[model samples]
Target: MNPLHRNKFVAAIVAVISLTACSTPDAAGEPASTTRRVTNAEHELVFHVLEGKSPALVLDAGGGLSSSYWKDLAPRLAKATGSKVITYDRAGEGESDEVSGPWRVENAVSDLEAGLRELGVTDDVVLVSHSIAGEVATTFVNEHPGRVSGAVLVDANVPDFFTDEMLTAFAPVVEKQKADLLAQPSTKKNRQLLAVMADYAPVHRVFHRRAWPKDVPVTAIVASQTPFTDSPEAAGLWRAAQERFAQARPNRKHVLAENTSHEGIVTERPDVVTGAVEDILKIVR
Candidate 1:
């Protein structure tokens, strides 16, 4: 079969295997909070506020994942910092409405801005972003400088390494799986979600345009193992991305966790992740 047909075939198989077969409702209960929908000139955004005391922190989850993924991480950061926490599902990933086109970095930033406005979180807020969220958060800070007090990147997405060849290779894969991927059951939804992320070169490029603000203390934690090492090239790509962050923000300290994967920062090393948040709080305070 030709490459195009082969990709479609693989996508079909992935769709069947990756359907949301395991998603369970929010067991933690109705979020103990309410979500406000903010409709922008172009998109609609959904966000929930976990009220605390002051100096609110907004949490953005990784790619192909929902805000619920940060369920454990958010409260821990909130309690540790003694500040309000906001976590929201970006469009097409969680309870939030999906956008008509591919998720763009600018759109994600706009969604975050609209959500904050709708919730009335106008203070100097700290934006905490994980994985791909690092890209979105950085863009937000650059676009709206004064709006952000500081930022903490948990295994952030770095774009300097996402070359044109990588994006071209991943585009057909995403186009083929776009449909069934969305229909996936909540549990298995991450399969197609990952595929879509594979095409997110534009989002990654946004990260290269700006560095973490000097006024904003940036914290990054890298996982021990690289997850997408299907090939040596893939492994190098992942390492290059991490290296870009290290090179760009040489002064920024990074904590490497052992026996951990990409999601480990949020799942296995909540203590470490929370510790980093606390460190940011100290600097910002």
Candidate 2:
């Protein structure tokens, strides 16, 4: 890989991996309606639906992750809210087929759209996005408009979080690790990481410019110990972006997950995630 591309990949992956690694939850008893593969172009994306009712909850995981992240919470959310809960493994992750080339938010949104339509979930969606998947949720909601009833962003990245300054700050650290990142075994997750990094800056720039639909109610749950532990300045920027995004339009709110880390929020502070989603469910209902 080119040095510049490598650097970009490293910069974004560091922040992403720091907050994305976790043990897959046990989904054994989930009230699954179906766990099937949906075709998107040439690749097959796996989707697991915990059946219930309309205004479904769609959970999108962060980079280098799979739907297994929601194993524990999906069923709980379904039982508590009595609304369908959906989780999927994006292409190149989990059981989904990998497609060559850089990761693109547009393609992700397309895959999601196709899968939902196949499942007969055309509208009344309540999106729950985490980390990099925030970009996916933002684009999906915007493109589909009335299809989405609301959204809950769980310590997810807001476009504002990807400022030039932060990218600059990432350079020194990323450059030092070039030899190591290149040397790591090329597993599926590693390949996906590289693809995301290859297109991180440019893709996020577009996301930064996107406006979340004004009518779509949202709640942003931000962790106290964010991904940027090494740099207080960067961490401050991350939190501030969440604040701004929460206040960017009406029907949006921000909740602070005190003492929680980004990676653990979904598991450790699932109540916060569930509570936020339920809040939106109330509004849309």
What CA root-mean-square deviation does each model show from the true structure?
A: 6.9, 5.7
Worst-scoring 10-residue span by lDDT in model 1:
15-24
For each candidate, the alpha-carbon lDDT, in order, equals 0.65, 0.80
TM-score of 1: 0.75
lDDT of 2 by residue, 69-149 (tens): 998888889988989889999989898999998788889999999999988899999999998888899899888889999
Clashing pairs in 2: none
Clashing pairs in 1: 20-185, 20-188, 21-188, 22-187, 23-187
Off by over 4 Å in 1: 1-32, 42-44, 164-207
Write model 1 residue lDDT over 3-66, tens digit each, in one string. Answer: 6544643443232111011222443522235566667766566676666665788988876678
- Give the candidate number with the greatest TM-score: 2
TM-score of each: 0.75, 0.88
